[model samples]
Target: MKQKIRDILAKHGGLPTPVDQLADDADLYAAGLSSFASVQVMLGIEDAFDVEFPDNRKSFQSIDAITKAVSGLVGSTEAAE
Candidate 1:
């Protein structure tokens, strides 16, 4: 899941720094993730995971946060499966 998120970020993050070079807790915005790019990343994640992020949940600051969010969504989806 972490690698999947990294792949999405690598494609959409628009960060000046390489996604692979970032630590899990690194602040993406600080690394040059623009707001528009973040949205693209969010959409990519949703498409990859087959899950929708809640409008109220605004937590995509770092790789770890995204991993946690995807884990929760995937866990529930798997339970339903």
Candidate 2:
């Protein structure tokens, strides 16, 4: 799951530093993740994982947070067994 999330970040993060180089808890805003890029990343994550993000945007703060939110959505009780 983390690897897939990393792949999404790598493809859409648009950071000055490579996504591979950033720590999971890295401050993505400080690393150059603009609001526009965050929207792109969110769309990419939804497409990749088949999970819709919540209406809130706070979970887009970092790769770790995004991964956790995606995992929960994808693993929800509403999901198929």
Best by lDDT: 1
- Which ranges in model 2 have alpha carbons more than 4 Å from their true place? 76-81
Model 2 Cα lDDT, one tens digit per residue, 1-81? 777777887788788898888898888888898898888888998898788887767787777787678868888553332
RMSD of candidate 1 to the truth, in angstroms, is 3.2
Clashes of each: 0, 0
Q: In candidate 2, how many Å is residue 9 off?
A: 1.2
Number of the top TM-score candidate: 1
TM-score of 1: 0.87
